[model samples]
Target: MTVDDSLSRGIGPVAMTVLPQAAADDDERAAAHWSGQLATFGLLEAAERHFRPAAEEGDLTAVKCLVWLARQDGREREAHSWLERAAGAGDAWAMYELGVSLPRPEGLEEAQRWFRRAAEAGHALAMNDLAALLARAGRREEAKDWYLRAAEAGVTTAMNNLAIQHVLGGDRAEAGRWFERAARAGHVDAMANLGRLRLEAGEEREAASWLGAAARAGHQGAAGLLAELPGAAEAAGEAGLP
Candidate 1:
């Protein structure tokens, strides 16, 4: 559909800055952009109207968005079909999504296969997930390797997970460094974790700072821990903590 057709259908005018003029003129890119915005606003019918045509034309991003829309509409089978079509075309994101969507235990092997493929294609999140699967299967060394790869690729969760691996390996120094890195990147769990580590090392002020940061980020556990620190509640209230 044309841009005017999209606007006429009550999708409203999208900000030009959000979508470049060149992309607006490209049918596939326009469809993907409009479908994503529609999907975000729960306009599933309108999103599908834009997405299906692009997906049929082999736009991997559109196929991925269609999969999400299908799942949101409780059409699991349709989502899987779209995922498979995109994954078959070697789309890294589609492979990762397909891996995560598969039923656990029964589909574990298939999920790992797809995760591995996606990871090999340089999908950072896939590397993190593959590490988790390997860790579950008692492959600690391989899991650590994958986690390191993902962490280096700037996945904050991978950095957190890798820190946990270091802790398990009794390398507290390395673990603390990783936790600090992830926390600086705004990973709430890592903030809580680093706070706990600091508390254990008798660095109460540092611990409270990290814990307060995590608490303000809506981490219930961090909030609870922060409440246990002396004078923390008053400090939090003074800082307008919500």
Candidate 2:
């Protein structure tokens, strides 16, 4: 199968079969699959062994695997090289990874460029991250637009961030709506934020409920806030709050 076809199918049953034959044949496609399996099992060295050969043979999937393996080994420069190679090949995830790996301050502009490319390529998380970069640069309107896109794409963090943007814009009602959506989607920060809003509005019961949920999910700030709420000690105990 072609590289693009293998990429589209991912590492499935077909890719997983006949490992011995694959190794004997030196099949780069099968090597990529084997590398993925090894990586999934936390066998980083073995994965790298397979990945290097396949990557050298021009397997973009293998190149991506090398990026992850390099990161795991704390080889940041090597990881960046692999990420750049895959991103240049039009891999959306690679572009996003490259953007995040770039050093802040000095690499901010380059990161933004990569994030925009990834987002334009339909990477939902990239949209959220790109929005955050814009927001940090004081581009509120543009940030809100990207955040809305990512939120609509079902990114829980984006939903939470979009809610924060609304809150900053003094739209409490809209903020609450988005916060609730993110909280219901299991975003811990959103639950805590929603709880705080409820507490400020004198809805102590609802605040406790949301804070308790966030606390149960291991949010220390939520646990602390929940502990301060009247009649919340028992709930905090039930949630094993720290």
On the 0 to 100 scale, the lDDT of residue 111 in model 2 is 94
lDDT of 2 by residue, 1-242 (tens): 64333433544334334343454343537644654564464455654665688788878867766765666567889989987888898888788878887887899999999999999999899999999999999999999999999999999999999999999999988999999999998899999999888888897777888898888899999999988877885754564322
CA lDDT, every model vs. true structure: 0.80, 0.79
Candidate 1 has a TM-score of: 0.75
Give TM-scores for every candidate, taking all chains together and pairing residue i with residue i.
Answer: 0.75, 0.74
Where does candidate 1 stray beyond 4 Å?
1-33, 36-62, 65-69, 232-242
The pairs that clash in candidate 1 are none
lDDT of 1: 0.80
The per-residue C-alpha lDDT of model 2 at residue 241 equals 22
Q: Please write out the lDDT profile of model 1 over residues 1-242, one tens digit for every residue.
A: 65435645554445222233323232435545654665565566755676588789987766776776676677889989988998899888778878998997899999999999999999999999999999989899899999999999999999999999998898988999999999999899999999888888897777888889888899999899888999975665565312
Model 1: lDDT of residue 126: 96
Give the clash count for each candidate: 0, 0
